[model samples]
Target: MSETQKSKPEIEAPQSPAPEALEIVDLVEGDGAEATPGATVDVHYLGVDYDSGEEFDSSWGRGQSIQFPLQGLIQGWQDGIPGMKVGGRRQLTVPPQLAYGPAGSGHPLGGKTLIFVIDLLGVK
Candidate 1:
């Protein structure tokens, strides 16, 4: 496989202004289907607390990609994940409001800025 095919997701923190809103950066530009609103997407992901660098959740660890409609996810995901092509990878830095809000999403998240490395596996 080529480097683009085997490259691991890079861990990165967004430079200023990222904490204020949703920040998205593409890591791999895929050559397949594009994500649109209401499209069903199959993806692998890793979620972490930005400030603490602690992993909060991951689909990669579960060995399965999840399929979900774009409209059913969080605001940041809804706004950010779209335009990604199948087989693409993205790094998103989401502020609390776009994430779980003040109450957080339960243990390990705590309403802080979140960092996610998402692999767009497929789109239908």
Candidate 2:
């Protein structure tokens, strides 16, 4: 199905232990432009905590896509979003070190693995 035809995505709860490294999965591959490092991206996304399967954020919930420079996001996003094409959907499983940091790093999500489903809408 085309990216435009798909509705908001729902992430299934993971049954396995979180990995020690980053994991990337493309749910839908878009045919548009490829996103390069340092590019600004417009995307719709959902974020959930790996252990509790609880949602922490989602652009879909707000009924809009967010746009930002790729370099300005968290480590996981900075590492994961580049090389994706606009119109594609990708899932990222980010370990704590690549996410907020090891558990006591002070960020609310510190020490936690995060799961994110991202839809690339545009790249600039």
Candidate 3:
């Protein structure tokens, strides 16, 4: 298998009708503060494929979210969490531009939109 095929994250397409607008349910909205590029944040996330509604990954099962530096994440995450606040929840409909682009990173995600329900629990 090629490297591209290995890094892509597996995600099914969304089956539900696309909402006209995104609904954000913030459990803890960060203080409207900007997070540093390499800042570490702990959050609970539910990810579903935009076209399939199939769950791709979730931190909720673990009973808690995980923490990692924004810079250490994929482009989608690096760009997505900066605006969130502690205790904030947001539904992010990530386009291919903001997510895994044309040539997927080679895990299971092959150039697809990712819908994420993110709950910002805290920042370290």
The local distance difference test score of model 3 is: 0.64
Model 1 per-residue lDDT at 123: 91
**Which ranking of candidates, highest TM-score first?**
2, 1, 3
Q: Per-residue CA lDDT of candidate 3, range 1-124, in tens?
A: 2232122233346556644333333434555445556789876777887877778788865665688888877676776677677656666777665666655568576566778877665676
For each candidate, give its TM-score against the true structure. 0.84, 0.95, 0.69
Choose the strongest candidate by TM-score: 2
TM-score of 2: 0.95
Residue-level lDDT tens digits of model 2 in 1-124: 3645257888888999999999999988888999988899999999999999999999988998899998888889999998899889999999998889987888999999999999998999
lDDT of each: 0.79, 0.90, 0.64
Q: Write the per-residue lDDT of candidate 1 for residues 35-106, one digit (tens) a residue.
A: 998798988888877876777788867777789998888788998988999878888898888887765458
Task: Say which prediction, candidate 1 or candidate 3, comes out ahead on TM-score.
Answer: 1
Lowest lDDT block of 10, candidate 2? 1-10
Model 1 scores a C-alpha lDDT of 0.79
Model 3 poorest 10 in a row by lDDT: 1-10
List candidate 3 stretches off by more than 4 Å.
Answer: 1-34, 103-105
